[model samples]
Every structure is written in C-alpha cells, then in structure tokens.
Target: MMPSATRTDARESGVIGLGFATLWRGIREQPRLFALAASGACLYTLTGVASSIVLGEATERIVLPAVRDGHADWPAVAVAAAVIVGVGALRALGMFVRRLAGGTVVFRVQGHYRHRVTRQYLRLPLSWHQRHSTGTLLSNANADVEAAWNPLMPLPFAVGALIMLVTALALLFATDPVLALIGLVVFPTFGWVNLWYGRRVWPLYAGVQRLRGEVSAVAHESFDGALVVKALGREEEETDRFRVHAEELRDAMIRAGRLRGLFDPLMESLPNLGILLVLIVGAVRIRSGAIDVGQLVRVAYLFTLLAFPLRAFGWVFGDLPRAVVGYQRVEAVLTAPSEEPQGTRNLTGPGPAALRLAAVSYAYPDASPDGTAALPGTAAPAGTASPDGASQDDAAGPSARSERPVLSEVSVEVAPGSIVAITGRTGAGKSTLAGMLARLVDPTDGAVLLDGVDLRDLAPGEVSRAVALVPQQAFLFDDTVRANITLGLDVSTEAVWAALRSAQADRFVAALPAGLDTHVGERGTSLSGGQRQRVCLARALVRAPRLLVLDDATASVDPRVEGAILAGLRENAGASTVVVVAQRRSTIALADEVVHLDAGRVIGCGRHVDLLASSPRYAALLTAYEQAARAAGTDAMPDPDLATEAVS
Candidate 1:
C-alpha cells in the first residue's frame, strides 16, 4: 500500500500533466498505431457529421418541397435516401477502423508498461525489496499498470467526441443561431458537473486502489503461511483479518459506484434537457419566420447528436483522475534510484580467493547512536580501529552517525585456499559478515576485498561468479533435481554428480523414483530439511566459486553427513577458500582458523586451540555451544569443559 503522504502527493500533482505525459510515452512507444487510431477517430467523426448534413439536406430539398407542393418527387426522394444510405455505410466502416486500432493501442500500452515495471523489480536492490511487500509489488506490475492505461481504451471515442461536438455546434449555429445559443448551455453544465464529479470520485478511486493492494497483501500472506496458520489453529484469526480488509475494499468500491451512478444519470439527462430547450427555442424562432421547418428539424437533429459525444466527454473526464494516480504509482517504481550501483573494475588474476575486510562496518538506518542492537555483525566496539589497521572514525564519518552499526570497525583476512570458521551467538552478525563476503550487500563503512580488489570496484557479475553463498535457509525452485543443481549451468552430468556427492546429497537423489529428473516442490517442500540443505549445498558447490561462504548451511544435515561434506570440502580446499558460519564443534573442528564475535564485534581470531588458551570469551562461548549441542542430543565435542579448563 502507498503511504498516505505519497498518495496525497500523487493526487496533488495535477492529473493533466501526468496523464498527458503517460499518454505521450505510450504514443511514442507505438507511434504508427497511435497515429492510425487517431486518424480513424477523425474519419469516424467527419463521417457522422457528413451523415447529419445529408439528413438535413434530404429533409430540406425533397421531403419538405414535395409536402408543400402536394406532389411526391419520387426521383429526388430516392436520390436523397440513397445518399443517406451511402453515408451510413461509410460511418460504419469508420467505426470498425476506429475500434480495431483503439483496441490494439490499449494492448500495446499495457504490455509496454508492465514489461518496464517487471524489469525495474529485477534491477532493484534487496534492501528496497525488504521495504515493500511482494503483493504490493505484484499489484504495481499488474493492476496498477492496467488501471493506468484504461483511459486509452475509450480514447478514440473521446477524441472523436471532441471533433464531433465542435463540428456539430458550428453547423447548428449556422442553421439557427438562437437555438444554438441555448444548446451551448449543455456544454458548460456538463463541464461543471464532471469537474465536480472528478474531485469527489478521485479520493474514492485512490482508496479503492490502495485497498486492493492491502487485500492482495493479506491474501498472499495467508496463503504463504498456510502451514503455520493451520498448525497453530489461527485460521479464524487470519480469516477475520482478511475479512476486515475485504469489507473495507467493498465499502470503497460501493461508494465510488454511487458517485459514478449519480454523475452518469446527470450526464445522460443534461443532454436530453438541452434537446428539449433547443426544440422550444427553435419553434419560437420558426414562428417568427427566422428559420424554416427543415432548419428547425436539422438543429434539433444536431442537438440529439450531442448525446453520444457529451456522454463520451463525461467518461473521459471521469476516468482521468484514476488513470493519473495509477500512472504515478507505476512511475514511482520506474524512477526509483537503483540500489546496486555499477562497478567499473574486473577481477582478473586469482589463486583460490584472497578475502579481506578493511575497516568494514554496517548499520541499519534506524539504529541508535548509543549502540542499541543493530543488524547482526555490523556494530563495532566504540573507538576500535579495523583489523586492517584503519580507524572507524575516519572510514565512517557524519553519515554513520544516524545509523546503528551492525559490524563495527572490524577487519579480517583469509589467505587463499584456507578454511575459516565464524561463530557467534544469535544476532552476533554472523550472517551479515557472510553477506558482505559475497557482496550481497555493501558495508556502510569500509570495504570488502576479493583478490586484493575492493568488492565494490568489481562488477556485480564478477563478484557473483567468484563467490557463492548458501544462506541458512535453503530455497529451491519447483524444478527437477538436476535443473535445481545445475541452475542453467553448462556443466556435464558427471560434474553434477560430483557436486551432489560432495554435499552428501547424491545417494538419496539416485534413489528417488525419477532419480535426477524428479521435481522438487516449491522451496523443496517435498524434501526433508536435511535433504533441502544438501541440495542447496550442491547448488553452490556445482558453481565452483573461488570463495564459498556458508551461513550455517549444513545445520539440518546429520552430523555424519555434515562431516563427510566437510571432508569433501577439505579435499578441494586447495582450489577454493571456504568460510563457514558454524555453531557445531564438528564443523568448527575442521576449520584451520576460528573467528569469534560478541555483540557484533570480533573479540578473538586464531586457531581453535590458540583461542581456547588466550581468549576467555572464546572458551566460554565454546562451553555454551557444547552445552546446547548436548541438550539437543548431538555432542560433536566429547569434552565440553576442556577448552575452558585449558584457558583457566
């Protein structure tokens, strides 16, 4: 849902400017089609004008003269009828052309805007995505785009209405100026009624659009969390919540309908009233001998013709405000600043991948200066210099003051082809560190280096190619096992098997009914937690990234399976550097070095034994890990207090 302030701004930003700009862009996109449609509209209007003129001429020349002379001019009457028939046929053809071209324009415009919005979603950063819900974004691409272009559907009719009204009024005045003067009152009245209607309806329509987004959001949440809702027996609560939003949407739509209903009747009646007024005035003028019966009849026919154009004019004005609001919403997404800035440099030379964090620190936008909790791993101890010997104060200046740092003034380096383990309590910023290593996000302060080049300096694609990060939650598309593992890579089946084997996932996959061809359900729901983790691990392994950062990726796997996976990684350690965010001692035992974090600050970094001897915090943390593991019936450490006793 759009913020109230944003919606207010959209409403205030003159609909004509945005609406015309949107129309102009659509025209520019398909100039030939738009031009053809406009020409058809012109042709259709002129044909209608011609038909009316032919009717007036037929009445004046043949019908009226024959009636006065008391003798039927059959030949002249037949010629006039034939001329009317010909004009009617031309008008029908013009209508056909106008409708065909107008429909094509509507489709093209809707498609063009939808495509642009979808592309913008892809280009936007994860941070931006975090701020908006999936349902709102979907509505922006689909419903909003549809609403924005809806005015185009009746565009040809509206354009022709303007032409018809102007031409018809000019002819009416020429035939009987006194009747034309009274008929013209309808135009100003129609304008005033619509102007009043638009103001009243704009807010209601905007509210309806907003409520639509809210309804979509609620539905999406309910569906996505179906399992949780059912398991927790919260279905009634969820249903009630959805019902509230639906009722609000219903109320908004009904209110908008009522306003439209009132306006439509007024618009329809006003034209009929004009026709009546014209008849009364035309009769008076006819008695005064200022105009003939044929002229009076023609002027009345022209007023009757105003009905179609006037209603179309009302439709155009009535729908314009909603279209403008929808377009502004779409434009907001298209014009938002890209979160991922392009980098100019490339990562060329490399052995495995040398990783470095130089004074790297990050903070959430709302974090407090006094160091309330921030995004895990972004805060640093106050006044501490980075591991690479850079000061945090120098690296992050005034801009950093507003942010609550998640990782603070911390730096660490891992040599090529080495395994380093990161361990911290929940919210210790373990995952944030892994994210920075993979360049999923940039540090608010300092830099992350790959092969001695700042990660930000390398193109995003280059960084992606060099680093593979398997987050704590393993997500898989609903695709075949082989496709999930390969993920569009041009790797051989043998390579795939090797990667699966390394992640300890091959045996189960081979046993499946279709082997590698078996489909994994959304997020791999058909698989057990361990199976899903292994599949995700295989996905990363198959890429053969120079640097692999695993954020507790193997937590669900059996200890024996995790050990095998770690051994496999160790065997290939010479070709790649491995960074594991681990809590299990079995996993940490395999790492050549250990980095322990406390409250987003790196308190110690060394080999496990070295840390146990020198850092009391490391030993205490290890004891906590052992106790938790024992409680969970998985004791990777046989001696829980050994490290603590050694330190003492």
Candidate 2:
C-alpha cells in the first residue's frame, strides 16, 4: 500500500500542477493564435465605435444643413460611405481571425490532453485500472477535453462586444445621461439571471455526461458480446436497457434545452426593452433640444448593436458552468492518486541478484464490488489475526493498511536460473503471488528483495528489466504479428523472429499470408485464444528479462503447442528465474520444485514425486488439473515421474 501521508500530498499537488502545466503549454504553444485573436477583437471594437462616431457626425453635418438651411453636403455623404466600407472590411478580418484562432486553440488543447492522459494511464497501477471502466477514460480523454474549450471559443467576441458597448455607452452619456443610465440598468438584471441559470445547468450537464458514458459502455459491451447476447436470446432485454440510458440522456438534454429556451427569449427581450426606454427618452430630449436628432439616431443604432453582444455575453456565461464541470471531471481522472508515485528511474540492465519475498502480505481494495479479499493481512475467516500474519480487520481506504493476508509471514527465495512452479487450487492466491514478484502490487508486511536490495529500492525500469508477467488473458494491440512480438524489446527483425521461434510461435506466424506484417485486429481478435497467448509469451521472451513470470500463460494453448513452447524454453534456459503459475500437470512437471498453496497459504513445497507422496493438497490439485483437461477433450494425463525427469 502507498503511504497515507505521502500519497495524499502527492495526489493533491499532482492534479493542480498537471492542470496548470497543461494550461501553460496551451498558451506557450499558441502565442501566434493568441495574438491573432487579440488583434481581431481590437479591430472589431474599434470599427464599431468608429462607425458609430462617423455616422453620427455625418448625419449632423449633412441632414441638419439640408433641414435647417435647405442645403446638402456631398462631402459628408462621401465620408459616410468610406466609413461604412472601412468598418465592413475590419469586421470581415475580425471574423476570419476569431474562427481561425478558436479552431487552433481547441485542436492544440485536445492534443495536449490526449498525450497527458496516455502518460497517466501508463503510470497508474493495475489495481487502479481494474476498478475503472475503459469507456469512462475514453470519454474523459476525448469528449471532456473538447467540451472544455467551449468557454474559450466565445472569449474574443465577448471581449470585443464589451469594449464596443462601453464605448457606445460613453458616447451616449455625453449626449444624455438619463438615457445612458436607463440603458445600463438592464445589465445588472441580466448578470443575475445568468448566474442563476448557470448554477442550475452545471449539475444537469454533469449528469448527462455520466449517462453518456454509461450508454457508451453498454454499447461497447453489447457489441463485444453480440454472440453471447444473440445465443442467449436476450436482444430485446439488452435493447430495453440501452433505451433506458438513452432516454435518460435525452430527457436531460430536453430539460437543458427547455432552460435555454426560456433564457434565450428572455435574453433577447432584455436588450429590446432597454432599447425602447432609451429611444423614448432620447426622443423627448431631442424635442426639448437637449440632444440633436443625429445624436438620437446614433444612440439607438449603437444600442441595437450592443444587443447582439450582450446576448452573446449571456451565452458565454451560460456555457461556462458546463465547461467547468467537464474540466473538473477530466481533472479528477488525470489527477488521480497513483498506486505508485512515479519518479525518474531507469532500468539499467540484467543484474545477478535473485528475488526474495520476505514476510509480505496484501488485501483487496475496499472499493471493489466483488468483495474479493487480498492475501496475507486481510482478516482471517475467523475474524481475527492469525498467528501466521493475516490481518484481523478489513482494509480501510485507498491508502489503508491491508487487513487481509494475501500472503502472510511468507518468505521465499528463487535462485537465479531456476524454474519454480506454484501449484494451487483456483482461489489460492497464486496469481497474487505472481503479481507481487513482478512489483504489480507492493506487499503489506515485509518486502520483496532483489539481491540484497529491497525491490522498491531499485529503479522501476531496473525492476521491469528484472521481471515480467504474462497474465492469463494475453492481450495484443490492433496491429501486425511482428509488432506484437517485438512490443517489449528494442530489437531488430532478426531478434523478433528469434524470440518467436523460441516461444514456438514462429511456425503459425510464418503460415499467415502477410507473415510478420499481418494485422492482428483489435486485441488480436483475428487470432485464436491460444495464438494470442503465444504472441504475448513471445513478447515477454523478446525482452529477455532476468525473471520470467508465467501466470497460467499456457492455459489457453493446445497441449501439443504448450509442450513445444516449454521444450523450446527449457533448451535455452540459463540463469533466469522462471516462475510458472500452473494448472496443467505437464506445466508443473517442468519445475525444479513445486510449491503448493491452500487458502492463501503455502502448505507444501517439494519435487513432484515427493509432493505426491507427502502432500494431499498437492495431489488433490494435480487430480483436479487432470480431470479438467480430460473434460476439455484431452485424452492424456501427464506422468509425474517422466515429466519431472524430462524437464530436470
């Protein structure tokens, strides 16, 4: 378990730091975009204010002359035409820059978010990933990042609008203070309404996003299990469940739409009401000769232009709550506390130190829905700490000390170059033990030591170089056979084929049409279960790590394929520690010694013949494996003595 004090501090600091760092990267990387947007906003506001002033002056100069003295000025008319053309040209440039800059910023921010999320995923622990759905992570990386840019898109236009409105109001105040003050009164009310609506919409949008994730998950699961769903004839049931989530999402959208429908019309009316009041008072002033007719015309036009932006300002604020909520949701994932805090550590090379587990234990996380208790350190079935070092209480939180004994007071040492096979029943913590060896999870009580140094003391890269675990469910990317085989190593084409040959995967791969270039499809769905496992096995072998961990890696392959792969591995064996979690009597027969586990405890350890004679649990486990293999259509059972003698 991670230390409570350290993990808490790091989690808090990391989330804030990562968020700000990403924000800084956006600004630094897009300086030109920022400049374009700022320049565009400046030009837009300047054009609006200049147009209003020029129009007002032109009207007073020409219309008043014609009305009072029966004379028209051609020069004033020409000047007004020039102002109109200049303002139109500036507004066009403003629109071009705003669109271009907004797009550039959104793209850059999305790229940054995708890269950071990928890095975070690689660094987070296996247990952390186990608890989260892949769909939610995908949504955070793709959808949430895109939505976060909503507020940013309207910023330049909003700023330009505000500047134009302020200038227009100042000009109006110069002519008539009473009308200007009345026009501004509606703004406070608009701000209050915006605040109220923004608060109400945030939670709804968050709920919608959550429902969207669920819908995606359901769709993904349905597609992945289409065969099972069809075979079970539950298509209608599945469809109904999907519809429930979809309808929930639709209803949320409708509610949000209704809110906007009410707000938008109200927003439109606010400015129009202000316009009516401004025009009425201005006409009175004009009649009293307190303001000129030209000035009154200018104020009215400017107020109308202000209407577009004021309404835009409301929208910008309206979208802000949703955008902020999206940002926070993404931040929660990107900034989550890691199971292991990463540092700058590099795995150097193959070292001669052996692996030693000294009094280690572990427990399942409290948040797991399955209530699967961990190894040594969890409360015993009797609800008390066992003398062997199992915990007496339940594990607490993310940073809690493990209470279940996933492994307790258990100490083992693997001599360099030896093969140690762990034999156990289905729930005997064999996989958990293998995980500990690979540093996938830290122990609760003692520590796993490499050579004389604690495993944690070695750099992570070094630890990775030392150990590798090929899990039961072997996974591959949607790529070619060569890519999957060479995934773990920085190797040439020759090296890749060599590893494949050693893992006995070279024959089938060579038979494919594209050979090394054959695309594997998603998770190697194009390949059989056994072929996928071989490819994963080849991946581990390619790296040539000092310690090779096989957690039932051969369980999926045919007995013939398994035998051939094991033969190849044994021929090349040297000083590497090979730990196999076995369910096959044939697989166990290859071990230098077999360790038997029962209820998370190692009850017996010895050579196969010795265990068969001395340990009933080991005999029972072997009998079960043989029975399972027979049921699966394999006619042969492994001869314990013959198989043991062959590998040894």
Candidate 3:
C-alpha cells in the first residue's frame, strides 16, 4: 500500500500544472522522437486550416462566379479540387509520422522505466520486498509504467492544438473582426471547462489507479493461496475479498466516467457555440457589406475545423490524473534505499571458506527505528507451518515478533570443510543465522566473516561464487533439467551428472524420457516434491561453492535420500564449509558439532549427544519432534516451525 501521506499529497496536487509538467518531462526525455511527432502534428494542423481556406476560396472564386454568370467554370474547379487533394495528402503524411513517432516515444520511455524499476527491485533488500506485496510490485513495474506514459500518445496532438488555436484565431481576425471575437470566447471557455473537469476528476482517477493495484493484489493473493483456500473451503471468502477490491475499483471508474460525461458536453458545446455564433453574426456582417461570402465561409469553416483541436487539450488532461499517480508510484520504487553497499575486494580461495559471526545481531530493515517489532511480513520473515509432518511452503514466521535483532549479539565460528548444525526450536533465529552464513541479509549490529575477511568487504558476485544458500522452498525455472542445474554456467555435461549423483537425483533424472533435456515445467511442477528438492540441491552442488548453507533444504526429501545427499556431501567435506539448519535427529548426529540456539542465543555447542544430556530445552524440543514423528507413523520430520512454536 502507498503511504497515506504520499497519497494525500498526490490528491492535493491538482492536475493542471502537475499534469503538464509530467507530460513535458516525458517529451524532454525523448526529445528527438517527440520533435518528430510534434513536427507531424504541426503539419497536420497547418494542412487542415489550409483545406478550410481553399474550400472557401473555391466557394468565392469558382462556385459563386459560375452561379452568377450561369456558366460552369470547369478549368478553375479542376485547379481548386487539385489544391484540396494536395493539402489532404500532406495531412495524411503528417498523421502517419505523428502516429509512428508518438508510438515510438511512448514505448521507449515505458521500456526504459520498466527496466529501471525491475533493476531496483533486485538491488533493494529483502526487508523492502516484505513491506510490498508481489502484486503491488508487479503493478509498479508493469501497469504503473504503462499508465505513466499514457498521456504521451496525445501529447503531440495537444501541442499542435495550441498552434492550431493560435493560427485559427489569427486567421479569423484577419478574415473578420466580429468572427475573431467568437474565437476568443470559445477557446478560453473550452479551456476553463476542461480545467474544471480536471480538478474534480483527479482524485477520482487517482482512486481508480490505487484500487487497480489493490484489485491486482487481492486477485494474486487468491491465486497464490489457491490450494490452501480450496482445502480450507474458503473459496467464497476469497471471492468476497476479491469482490470488495474489485467493487471499489468499479465504483471509482464509474465516478470518473460520470464526471467526464457531465463535463464533456460543456466542452463539446463551446466549439459548437463558436460556430453557431459565427453563422449568426456572419449573416449580419455579410448583409452590411462589411465581409463578403468568401470571408464569412472561411470564418465559420475555421471554427468547425477547430472543434476537435480545442478538445485535444481535453484528451491530454483526461489522461493526466492516472499518469501522475502512476509516475509517482514508479518514482517511489526507483528512489527507494538500496541494500548494503558492495565492496571492491574479492575473496580468493580454492579450499572451503572459514566462517565467523562476530556478535551478530539482525533486525529486519523495515523494523521500527526504536527496535520494536512490526507486523508478520515486515519486521519478521514470512513462512507458515502445515499440520502435516512437513511444511508445504514454510520457512519462518513472526514467531518472537520483535523489532530487536531476531538473532541477538552472540558469536560463533566454523572451521573450513566442517559440517555444523544450527538447531533451534522455531523462531529461535535458526533461519536468521543460516541466512547470515550466505549474506542473504546483513546483521543490524556486528558482522559475519568468511576466511577472516568480513563478508561485506567482498566485491559483488564474490560472495555468491564462494557461498550457496538453499532454502526449504525449492525454486526452479521452466526449462530443461540441464538448464536448471547449469543456470547458464558453462558447466560440462560430465560435471552436471556429477552434481546430480552427489545430490542423489541421478537415478530419477536418467529415467526421464529425455534424460537431462527433460523440461521441468514452471517451478518444476512436473516433478514430485522430493525430486524438485534434489534438483535444487544439484543446482547448488554444480556451483562447487566453498560454503553451502542449507536452511532446511531437505525437508521435502525422504530420510533415505536426505542421508545419501548428506553422506555424499560428507565425502566432499574438505571442499566446502557446510551449515545446516537441523531438525531431524539423524541430521544432528552427522554434524561435526551441534550449535544449539535458544531465543537467539547459543545455549549449547558440542556433540548432539552432549547437548541432549545437558541442555534441557534442546532435549525437550528434539524429544517433542521425535514423538510427533512417531505419532504420525512415518519417518517424516515434523515441521521445525511447529515444534518451535510449541516449545517456545
């Protein structure tokens, strides 16, 4: 959601100057193209005015003479008709250039800003993402960008309308003083009516744009949680939730439409009145011998031609409110503070990177400045627990819900090539600690180091090359298995197979119809849960990272397959430092040493057997986990998040 202060400011900033200024900025950004479009618009306007003049000349010189003399002036009529056709051809050419160049300007500006927004998305910290929903971000990058540039399509037309209005006014005055007076009144009235319409419609348009995002958000929420909704029989509830946002959007659009309808006629009638008044006064002027039939026809025709040109301003202003809101929304993303600055230095090592956490204390970026907890998705990470033994998509929750560092000041070290288990009940900050190992997030206070060098000091891509963090939720792109594993890396087929073997995913992959070439579909939906987890593991393994942080990465895999992967990793122990967020007793037993965390502090560290005998909380949590597994009548590990919630 946008901040109330920002939205209020937008509502207060009326559409007149702001809309014009916004349109000017876009034109300025793509000057060359807008110049072409403007040039075309000017040509179109000039030719249109010329056509009216030519027609009036035909009436005065050829038609009137033929009627008066009772003879046909075929030669002169041919000449007049040729001139009109020539003017129209030029007008058509101008319209073509205006449309083509104007379209180019819009797409280029939109594409430029869309790239900027998405790049900013990647550069921002996870904490920032938490504050915004996926739907809102999508709206910002896609819908908002397009909306921000919507006015550009009509901008050149508006620019040319100004020229047309000025030229028409001058030509009318030159034609007859009485007719010029009508132009003066009609044009300003058109502007005034549009101005009135803009002021009243801005807030409504802004409301419609804002609710567009909300509707998208609700629809995304329903779609993303479809399985849960269906299982819980909450389809009607989700539909109602979506309908509320949809109805708000519908109401806002209707209000805007109604407002436009009420004012359109007034704007439309001003030009009609100009023509009507011209005809009325024009007859009087002709009878008085002050103006001839040619001049009267010219003045009235100019007014008729200018009806649309005057309303061109109306077109631009009509789109202005939505454009302003969208531009402001996009600006918010572009100007948002970025993540921790990267360093120029790179880590150099062939062996595993040693690990260190020096009094690490991490508070989410969106947490209160005073260190007070925020809502579930902001101050705390987002994840949930399933009633089943395993989490369907669980990561961590707002367990402790503290604005203070989830992982309080405490220090630990891990030797290179050693496997260490970071165990805690739920929200004891185990996942937070695991994230530190991979620098997915930086600490609020203190530091995490690798090989005696602070992680922050390493240049961008250095940390990624040296470390790989595999979360419980396995993400796979829609591509071949080989493509997912290599991920554009120039790894050979042999190496891919090697990583697959190590991850214990070789057998199933080889059994596929196309082997490594088999398409995984989106998020690997074609594969079973365990197969996806193993493939993700293979992806990490292929990198040959020096540090591997598995944050409950094996939750979906069976115990046998998990053991095989752990065993294979053990065989290659000296190549990478392994940090596992452990829950199962078997996993804890294999670690070189166990780091038992309780309430964000390391309560015990040593062999798992030693911790069981010493730390009561550790023993109770594991005891609860094992008993729950037994009660479920399966070897599946109970969700650590659920266990921790119970213990805490």
Candidate 2 accuracy as TM-score? 0.85
**Given candidate 1, what's the lDDT at residue 101?**
86
Q: Each model's C-alpha lDDT?
A: 0.77, 0.70, 0.81
**How would you order the candidates by lDDT, starting with the best?**
3, 1, 2
Candidate 1 residue-wise lDDT at 623: 74
lDDT of 3 at 646: 53
User: Best candidate, lDDT-wise?
Assistant: 3
Q: Per-residue CA lDDT of candidate 2, range 323-346, in tens?
A: 654566566667778766444445
How far out, in Å, is residue 285 in model 3?
Answer: 0.9
Ten-residue segment with the worst summed lDDT in candidate 3? 372-381
Model 1 C-alpha lDDT per residue in residues 1-648, reported as the tens digit of each score: 345555565567555545656666776777787767767777777777787777777788888888889897899878888888887787777788878888898898899899999998877765555445556677788888888887776777778878888888889788877787876787888888977887778778777877776687788878888999999999999999999989998999999999999999999999899888888887888889999877877777777777876787777777877786677678778988875677889888665899888888877544245431111111222332222122121123324434456688778999999999998665567777887787767788899998889987887589889999887778889999999988899999999999899999999999998989999888798899889999999999899889999988887788889999999888889878999988777788899999998656899998988988898777777777676556667654333235334434
Best model number under TM-score:
3
What lDDT score goes with residue 162 in model 2? 76
What digit string (tens of lDDT, one per residue) describes model 3 on residues 478-512?
A: 99999999999999999999999999999999999
Worst 10 residues of 2 by lDDT: 375-384
Give residue 477's lDDT in candidate 2 (0 to 100).
96
